[model samples]
Target chain A: MHVRGLVDGQEFLVKHANGLANGVSELQHLFPAGSNVEDSDALPVIWEKPEEFAAAIDKAVAATQKFVAAAESGDKEAISSAFREVGGSCRGCHDTFRVPQD
Target chain B: MIASGARRLAIAAGLLLQGAAGAADDDLIAQGKYLIHAGGCITCHTEDADDAVPLAGGYALQSPFGTFYAPNITPDKETGIGNWSDEDFLRAFYEGTNPEGDAYFPAFPYTAYSGVRQDELLAMKAYLFSLEPVRKEIPEHDLPAFMSSRLAARAWQLSYFEPARFEPDTTNSSAWNRGAYLVRHLGHCGECHTPRGTLGALLREKELTGNPEGADGESIPNITGDRKDGIGKWSLSDIEYFLDIGMLPDGDFTGGSMSDVIEDNTSHLTPEDRMAIATYLKSLLPAD
Candidate 1:
């Protein structure tokens, strides 16, 4: 499918990106820590660098908000740019905090 | 005084010739700039710092061998390749050697660059020479005892390297040929994507299959045409758009070293070129 498809179907993306905040607030950090989750690619850096992780989560949330605003405005150019930033924010966190996928 | 007709014609001819020459030089330099980007020089040459100057090499490359710092390629006479003559420049790319005729470490990716045409290499050099010279001294590579000397690098080159020019397949489409040239030669995507041999040489037979032990402890994703194993699911436009903006078809952006590559190299490419790359990639065999 085309990137147009991605732009048109922004709900899943918006939800996925914005949900990072929920991860930051409750689900991301555990009280005991160092416990293994089955089938998880969660890297230790996520827990180790809580401050940086929170900041990354915040950036992603902000970018996703901008993306939602851009989508609502119906300006294709603005939407595309905001969508890219949203993607970049996701990447910014994934590259450092998450596990490197195969 | 009115000039004679022949003299006036001569002067006019001279001006025309000079103008033509200047335009040619401009085109050459412009082509060089584009080629340099295609060659993926900036990402490696520029240091990983906020204040890092472009092409004033201090970029640290972490490989299985060691941490290899990219040297200054800026036109600083003593610290850079400013003093390299045209022949020296060509040798660097074509022969994978330095101006002094010493073999360079394969970390430079001259193996792929060896396939670049001589004129294109010169064009890349012309563009580099036009840049503002930065006299930055690069730190030496941190290597183990076995990897210490130029001799070791020379030995590796002797074993695995072959200086060759890219020969186009006449049967292929122009777009395919262009894509091949960019992917295999200038872009050198296979250097990281293609899995390596025990000796650290690229496994040419399995190009774009993705490497498990890539630089900086990352597993490079396979871009072959496999539906399950590779990028067969990605449409040509999706690939092109991803190259342009680093966004995947699923709306996720890559956050790996591929991010820097997209920012510095592929995004700057023409849309046509990116599509051509997609075309070539689409043609690759699926992993078994």
Candidate 2:
């Protein structure tokens, strides 16, 4: 993040974080029943805090919906406007709960 | 058993506290650096293409109006802002008035900068200070006949100078504010999107209406949420993804100025900040 320019770092980090979050959420859904889940190194997010997990997904989805609507409209201003909101929701969730790599 | 649990809780709380403090500073500094790139400070500065001297300005901004020279912003006491007080920096930004007490040209983008937050500006200063200083001097701007005086910049500012800070729309979420800060101040989107007056100043009221007769003759597109030419088809995630990797939702990478923008500025910002800009831009009522 420090070495790369602002836009590159932002784009890379946000996308990677979103990908990680998606992967984690998918794993949460695929967890086997009574398969020593408590002993796992996972953050215990979706299973433990279902409401918050749902809320995060909801926010991200809503932001994405807004963005898609803007983009579909083909309005330059609209797309420019909604795009950042989508990126923000991704970062907001990541910063709050996800641990950064060392 | 309760004591052991309490000890674990205390340790976890301490770690969180440490992370929070360190993260905020890091986040702010990171944001400032990104803003500088979005602002495109380097393209006009650094003469050496090989060496990455972020803001030791030496690049030539050629135009029909004149050939403007970017100044060194490295933290050198004699040539750069190494000795500039915070007040000096703020005055230069907020008023388009430089350390020499003279009004700067709109090319400096102080008009947009006026909307920037003080803390963020300070962070940019911190980041600049942290860079390696390159002692290089740029020649003064060479204007054509009948437009030679620097005083003309003062006249332009007097007509267009409306210095103000960014006030977040209270109804909007914090995410929106983050976006507004990046777009309006740091990104200075209007520098290109907004049309310039006959005197080479931005037409503030008609911002982002498109500039077909722009300086480079390349039309700067209208981005005012307009359905026709605006980016209405993008998802927030699409926008974020595009800004991050310069790849459109349709899998196309942006080239030209936007590519440079993605590389320099938008790509470095935090996801939240980038989204904030996207959100704020999306909220704009469509123009045409």
Candidate 3:
């Protein structure tokens, strides 16, 4: 799932699949430790701004699910679409909090 | 008198057949010229400066592993591939092994070429043969001593190499198959975008995910739809337009290796071909 140095295509897809699964797990980690649920790092603002953050997360989860399914079925078209969804979620999250690297 | 007439007629027919063969060769050579342009031979072989001759080779390709000298492939009888037979040319491409039986460094991009059609490769040969022979001599590669031995290359090929041809995916549309063939063979895009291992072999598993340090220290971006790290924002039209005119969807013009790529390869391809490439590329799911 580590993105830093991966280059192989098969491994990339496998890693990506794991990462999407992990993203679902990590969604909980976005919140800060020891604070109220509202004060977590992942920002309940996601829930607060239901239209933006919630929609983004929903799309990401859906994409990840589709990605896993398509990849499993060997459907390239569906896999590609799922990958785009995953990208959307990452961009949406970064746009909210992370700086652009390029 | 009848026997004499029959003999004359036979000679005339033989002459006609020879003429037809010559014309066919000429037509094949012309087709090869077109394929060569699409194959991006000029981009790597020709130096950027005015002194360089197209397809004469001698350009230095920089990679994280080491510098690879694109050899003179022009028809120079002594320095180039001019003296190489059709078999030699085919083996070089199909096997990624050099004429000397030494395994070529993957820097040659033969992995992508492994899928090319036989006729297409022959056409490339024909086009290359038709060029005005250039006599410029290129230098040997400056690899580290440990990596310089051809035996090491032989071992590398033994372990990693798998010679194969382009197998059309029967379920896919013809456009998709053509795109796959072009991307995998003629385009050899994976040679740049895919990451290589310590010995300069492509990590086939990581094909086209992206290479941070590829040709010339450029960060070859992940083409997969990783929104944060890849081109997930791009539409199919965006991809096609970029290939067609080297313009990004945002209207910015590219200036580096991609610019040269489009100019030499994708730009010359038909619009339908470009769209197919776009379609195939856009189809890769971004790694999370």
Candidate 4:
């Protein structure tokens, strides 16, 4: 949900975070199941399907790592595609595990 | 030899006429294929599977009304629309009736389809006929007894529906007009995006602001000009790219039913058409 406020095309707000090797994951935090969390968008499937959820996280981690490298490389074209792929990786998990917002 | 030359010229003329006719058929078929995407036929009609046949039609749509299983639309004689004439196809959309005069349930979204012109419907039919036919029988809808009868659908149509064609707003730009036609009729974005009334009729005043209860019991987001509730911050390119690939203005990609729409419908549209849709969406008044 932290990324919800960060609009696409305008990454200037979080531009300072670019130096981090895993900037994408730096913003992502998955609370443990049964934690005292309220108003969380994470669905029960995240806990129920542990293996699938873990696999999804692995994919996202790799995507974030690639994105970090691309951003640091200073290659505009590569950065754009990597950035989009990172979003795709997040969506792969969100589709099943996140409660859709109205 | 002079007589032979005249015969050869006659043969050449005959071939030219035949080529022109063949080209017309090809053009009609091509346009129809594009319209199929614009009309969102593939997304609903084709079942969700890696090997699903195009337009074989077993996709299910979950609504407050019931779970509607889209029937086979292929040109197969046994289970598809092979026997439907041009008029039969037109009546289905324009009047929301089957070839046998039975009223279809509101799940079909023909209320929005009513605005489509006759020629386009025929072209769409022509395209369907050109495809390889598949014989697939669909399941009956699971509906409550009160709404199960065809009479119920007929009554609903009489009360809440009006068959209307698109009227271009003369004052607006041509692109805007095209966008209006595509969004209002062909694309039928309002079917999911627009909030529905008690009887499942779309609420015109609350158009495109969003729906809490949408397809598959998921909430659909607002795309109006409201900064807080809608996509007011998104530029035209943002909306176009979103439609193209299901990526949200947020660095995250959108998923669920909309992902299917992006893959089957908007992704296939030309950049100009996507931009037109973006322009039209941006022009709507913001509502709370």
Candidate 5:
């Protein structure tokens, strides 16, 4: 759902402006207390560095909010830039916290 | 006299504009720099050291034949390609032959490079020459006697190598042609992705269908339209995203040599070019 929102461009963003914000905010709550699955691709770095993980989540949330604001404004360029920021935040988190699949 | 002076000023302005245009055209170094990423020269030419000098060339490429050490491509007169003439460089790429006219080992991927345009090759040479030369003499390849012979390379070429330039398909979009040029010539993705014959010749019929064993003996994934084995389900944006940041559709980042490739090559390409690659890949027929 998040991937679609991120890659599907303005139509999806405009349609799911509120839903996108809600979905992104849910990311912060994803790593629960003592929630570690054996087959999960989430790296141990996410758990080992709690503060850093939280910071990454904060970045995502901020970017998502900016995207929502751009969607509301109906400025095409602003929305695109905000969307790119959102993607950048996702990349930043993944680079550090996600295990690479073969 | 006043009219004559004004005419002279106009002529001078015209000359200045022409000079500016020529400068833009002569920026082959910049073009070559971009093409270098397209060629993926750094990944092979540079050693794995964090502070490794670029293109000094000590990377060990392990193949079925043997482990081949990449040579110094820097323009150092004695140790690098500085002494090589333009014709020598072109022939190396075009025929996989050295300046002495001896066949180069297939490990060099000169078979794929053989298809590159002469102008582009010249630009690449220009860019390489522009670099600060690093005088690093790499050791020779650790190969079996049979494989070490230049005759072996010549035999391999006779059987499998066919030198040709990229012929753009007029029926296809310009993007597709660009993609084909990149994949077939510059990127040389087939060198690892495609299955190889006993002689280490790429199986042209099964290009980009994926190799069971690739560089460093890793299993390269099929990138064709095969739903089960290939990237059939990946959207163009998904592929673009993967190239840009090494993120798979399932949210996992890529690992291994591909990870390095993403960092040094694909990540630097323009988004439009990435999309072009994706488009071309998607258009391929599904291969089992």
Candidate 6:
């Protein structure tokens, strides 16, 4: 949830990269059962197309991995590009898989 | 030598004409594509599935009146509008009449579409015709008994709808006029953003102030210049960036309907057009 906050402000890019690198693996397992809460915005496609959903998660993980390496390099240009990739990965998944919010 | 020269001239003229025709077709299709983005047709036409066929049309739009299923707009011959003539298409957008001369529910936003130029509508049709045809037959609308009749739509049109083209204000800048055209005609932003009267007529006086009961019963935010209630805090760049990527100035990506709009419509617009829209939004009077 705080991924947006961390990735958005360049000041927090380093912190976001660290958090994503450390937390993405755990995030992958968070939706193990495909169970949805009453107020959850997770779309049915997540459960229906498990393979595709898993692939999307893998993309996020891969993007985050790249982002972490870029952040560690301490290069603003590289970090920015990596951060954008990570954001793209997240947005790509959310566009079709997530339930729309009100 | 004279005969050869004459033949060469003929060949050159033919090639020139062919090239000019090709360029014109390309321009028409490109313009159509842009107008489609502005119209946000995909948002309602395509289902919410990740792999949903674009423009295949099975999205169920829940309105207070009823559930209206968007019909397939792809070039499929049987179930879609593939066989619709240019006049058929024009009539639908200009007069809210279907190919069969039946009245269309206002959910199609033809009221705003009526303001679009004839050439622009034709370009839109050209773009739609260019799409891969999908044969999807959407279910008919499920409406309340009182609102189910096509007559109801026709009556509504008589009461509130006006078939008119967008007229530019000579006093405004070209950018402002462009913005007005996009927002008021092609974009039809007011259809959702503006509050409606009891009979679903748009409250023009409160344009862009926001709608409490907007599409899908969601409360749309005020986009006017009100500091507390609207996007007054956002800069022009902020608006442009948000439209492009759905990212707020506060660093949060938007969710819900606006997100879909950003992804499908505004995101595809050129920077100049987005700036034009921003200019128009900024000029609006703040309303509650």
Best by TM-score: 1
Docking class of 4: acceptable
TM-score of 5: 0.74
lDDT scores in order: 0.83, 0.67, 0.73, 0.81, 0.82, 0.83
Rank the candidate models, highest lDDT first: 1, 6, 5, 4, 3, 2
List candidate 5 segments past 4 Å from native: A1-102, B1-26
Please, what are the lDDT tens digits per residue for candidate 3 over residues A11-99?
Answer: 56766686766676566445443433543334445545646655665666776777677666555556655654555455456445332
Q: Please identify which of the two predictions, 3 or 4, would achieve the higher TM-score against the true structure.
A: 4
In model 2 chain B, the worst 10-residue window by lDDT is: B249-258
The residue ranges of model 1 lying beyond 4 angstroms of the native Cα positions read: A1-58, B3-23
Every prediction: chain A TM-score: 0.68, 0.55, 0.56, 0.68, 0.83, 0.78
Per-chain TM-score, chain A, candidate 4: 0.68
Reference-based lDDT, residue A101, model 1: 67
Candidate 1 total steric clashes: 0
Of 2 and 3, the candidate ahead on lDDT is 3
Q: Which model, 4 or 6, shows the larger lDDT?
A: 6
Residue pairs in clash, model 4: none
RMSD of each: 3.8, 18.3, 15.9, 4.4, 5.7, 4.3
Docking class for candidate 3 = incorrect
Task: Give the lowest summed-lDDT range of ten residues in model 2 chain A.
Answer: A1-10
Q: Give candidate 4 misplaced runs (Cα > 4 Å).
A: A1-39, A46-92, B1-11
Stretches of candidate 6 above 4 Å error? A1-61, A64-102, B1-12
